[model samples]
Target: MTQATAQTRAFVTGFIPAIALLATVAPAHADLKICNRMSYVVEAAIGIDDKAATATRGWFRIDPAMCRVVLQGPLTADRILLNARALGVYGSSPIPQNGSDTLCIAPNDFVIAAARQCRQGQTAAPFTQITPTQADDGNQVAYLAEDSEYDDEQARLAGIQRLLVIAGYDAAPIDGVDGPKTQAALAAFLKSRGLSPEIVQSPNFFATMIDAVQAPSSTGLTWCNDTPHKVMAAVGTDDGKTVTSRGWYGIDPGKCLHPDVTGQPRQIFSFAEAVDADNRTIRLKDKPLNWGGATQLCTRESKFEINEQGDCGTRGLAATGFAAVDMSGGGKTLRFAMP
Candidate 1:
C-alpha cells in the first residue's frame, strides 16, 4: 500500500475527534466550540473546574479548517483550561499556549480527576488557561490560528524550523532558539528550493510554508528523546532482504530526529546513547545511560553509515545491540523516554 493509504488507515484506527460532526452554523444553543484555523490536524483536551471536582478530558481530533464543539450545552465553567497537540508523528503543535494551569493527559482518550501527581500510565501535559468571552447569545468560540504565531524571536525561529522539518529538511529541533544547526538547515532548504534566504523572516513566507508542509510523509523512521540529556541515536533498517546500519544522529534534549533516509522498511532497529553538555556519558547508579535491546547491528565509535550488517570485526565496526522496532509495515515513531 501507498503512504497515503497507510496514513488513512492509521487515522481511521487511531484518531477520534472530541466531538461528532460540527454544525454548519453555530448552534442556537450555548456551547463551547474550538475552531482550528491552522493547517495541520490538532487534538484538544479540556479541563473544567466546577468547584466540586476538577476533571480533565481529551484526545479530540480536529482537522484543518474545521471546528468542533468540545463541550456541548451552556458554558458552565467560569474558567476553562485547554491543551492541544498536533495530531501527527512529528508533534508539531505550534499553537501558542498561555497561562500557568497544567493538566494530566494520556496518549489516548482519557478522563482523569487528580490534576497533580498523575498516576501510573498518564503523562503530565501542560494545559493553557483560556478565558472565553461571553457572547450576547451566551456562546463561546476559541479560534486556534497561526496569525500571531509567536511573540518572541526564539518562537519565530523555532516555527520556521518546524516548517523546514515538515518540508523534508532535517532542521534540528524547534527549540525556539536560532542556533547554528537551525541556520544551516534553513540555508540549505532555501538554496535547494530556489527561494531567497531572507524570505525566511517574512510572515507571508512562513504562512505559505506551513500550508505546504501540513501533510506529513509516512516513510522513514523518527526518534524522539524525552530525557533531559542530549542523545546520540543509531538506526538499522531491514528492507526484508538486506539490512543497513547508520549512526550518530545527534538529538538535543526534548527533541526528535528523523534520519535523512527514504522508503518504507519492514523492520527498524534503534540504539540510543545519552550524554551531558560536556560529552560525558550519564550514569544513574552505574547503569548505562542508553536505550537498546537484543537486536545486534554493526556500529562504529565515529559517525558512519555502513551497508553491510554482518562481519563487524572484519569491517572494523563494533556490534551494538539495537532494539528491534515494530513498524507494522508502515510509518512509525519511537520515543526514547526515561523511566
Candidate 2:
C-alpha cells in the first residue's frame, strides 16, 4: 500500500512530518525508506532483485507512525519486495502485508544474498513487490497501512485501539477516529491501571499498554515460551457444532502471549514447536522437536484461520498434532519448553 501527495511524500512523528526531514534534511546518498501507517509496530523485510540476482534482508522494527530507512546507499534493484508483519503483540501473527514472490528469511536479523531457496535454518514467506514513489532527490519511499487506510495520527489511534482490545477492553472500529467507543474504552483502561488520563498521550503509553497485554488474563488461554529458542504456536477450539483452528503465533523466549479466541468452547487444542534463530524447527535425538498430542488439525505455514479439520493436505494445509487443552477451570496456561 503506497500513498503520497504529488511532489511530496505524506508521513509521520509529532508536529513534524517525516517527509519534511527527507526532502529538506536527507543524507547525501539516496536511500530506500518505509513509513509505518499501520495500527501495530511492524518488522519489515526487503527483497531486492537487481542485475540477475535477488537478495533479502529483514526484521527492521518500525513503531507506529514511524519510518525507517531499510536499504541505504544508492538503489540498484529493478524490483523490490516487502513482507511487513505486525509485532507478536496481537497473539496470532496478523496476516502479513506481503506479495507474491516467495523468498527466504531468517528468524533473526540477516542478509541473504541468494533469496530463492530456504537453507536449513531459514524459512520462506511471500513478499509483495513494491514500487516506491521516487522523491525528487532520487530517494524511494513506501508506506504500510492497515485496511482502514490510516494517516500518521490515525495509525497511532488505531494502534491504541488494537492494544486496548488485546488488553481486554471493548474498543471498536479501530479506524483512527476518536469516537465515543474509543473514549469510553480509554477511560476504562486508564482507570483500571489507576493511571491519570493524561498518561494516554505520553510516550510511555505504549509501553504500559504492552505490559498489560503481555500479562496473564483471567479468561481464555495463554501460551508461554519457556524454551531457549523461539516457539510458534497454534490453537483450536470446538463448541460441539464446529471446530476451528489457527496458528503460527511466534513467542519470543521467556515471554507469554494469549491467542485471541472467542465464545465458550467445549474443547481447546494446542500445538507448538521450538525453532532456532533462522526459523528452522529444532531437532533433538534425530526427531523433529514439537509439543503436541494425538489430535491432528489443519494448519498452513502463514497466518491462517482454518474452519475445517478434515483432509488437511487436500485443502493445501498441513495436518499437525494438537493436544487437548485441559480447561476444566476457566483460564489455562500452556508452557513450551526444550523437552
Candidate 3:
C-alpha cells in the first residue's frame, strides 16, 4: 500500500505484543498465534520487547476464519505491539485495528529495531498493544475482531464476497450469509479460472483469489510497478461529460494492480511517482522519479477523489499533471520503470 509520507518515533515504556490468534484452541507452548475473526482480510505488523531490546517485524496476511503462528519459540517478551490494515483491493482502505503506541514501519515486509527514531524512507503509525489470552503462562492466542462480529463461517464467506467484488464480480451486501448471488459469483470465478467446483473448499482458495484480483485484466486500466522502489498512482476519467480524479493506489515493485475504474469513460488519465523505503519520493540526480503529463488535476497528500478542477490551491488541494492514456484498445496497462 502507498504509505502516507509521514514519520515519527517515541519509545514507550509500556509495550504489548500482538499476533494472529488461532481460531481453535492452540496447543500449549511458548509461542504466539494470531487468529482472524474479522470480516475483512487483513495484514498485520508487530513489535516485541525482550526486556533488553524491542524488535519489530511483519506485514503478515491473515484471512478470515484462519489463524497463523507469527511468533514461534519462547514467549519471554514483557510487552508487544500490533498494527493491522485491510487489504487494499477493497476500494478505500478500511479503518485499521490500531492502538495509541506510535511505531515505525516500512512500506513492505520488514524487520527492524524499535529503539532509534525512524530514519529516511520509513513511516510511523499507531500500533495497538495486544495481549493474547495466555494458557499455563505459556502458549497464547490473540483474536482479531471487528465491529461486524462475524463468526468463523460468516467471516470466511464475507471474505470471499469481498474478494469477488474486487475481482469485478457482482457480489454485494457482504453480510456473510450465503445466497444465490454469492453462489453465482463463485461459480463464475471458478469457470473463468478453470478451477474445479471442489476447489472452493481448498485451503489455498483465498490466496488463489488474492492472486486473481491483482493480475492485469485485458478489459480495464492496470498499473504495473517495474521500478526498484514502490510506486503510487492516481487516475482521472472523462465520460464526455463530468470528469473525476482519484488515487494513491500503492503498487509494489514487480506487481500490477487494477484500480477501481468502472464503466467506459471516454478518456482516461494517469499520474504516478516512485518512493523509497522511507516514503520519500525517489530522485535520480535531484529529479524525482515520476510519471505524468499535461492534463492537470487536483490532488492532495492524503487519499482523495476530487472533481472541482479549478483553483485547486484555494480548495486546499494540489494541482498535479495527469497524462492521458491511449486506450483505443480494450484494456490498457501502464508500466513504471527506472531510467
State the C-alpha lDDT per candidate. Answer: 0.62, 0.73, 0.73
Best by TM-score: 3
For candidate 2, report its TM-score: 0.75
Clashing pairs in 1: 17-61, 18-60
- Greater TM-score among 1 and 2 belongs to 2
**Candidate 3 C-alpha error for residue 33, in Å:** 1.5
lDDT of 3 by residue, 1-339 (tens): 234432210111011123233344344357787778776677777888677676778788888888777889865677767777666555335333346666667656888886336766456667767667665546677878756677789889988987887677777877888999999999998998999998888888988897887787776787888898877788899988878898667777887877777678999999998866555677789888899999989977666678778899999888899999998998888889988
lDDT of 2: 0.73
Name the 10 consecutive residues with the lowest summed lDDT in model 3: 7-16
TM of each candidate vs. truth: 0.42, 0.75, 0.81
lDDT for model 1: 0.62
- Which ranges of candidate 1 are over 4 A from the true structure? 1-29, 91-98, 134-139, 147-339
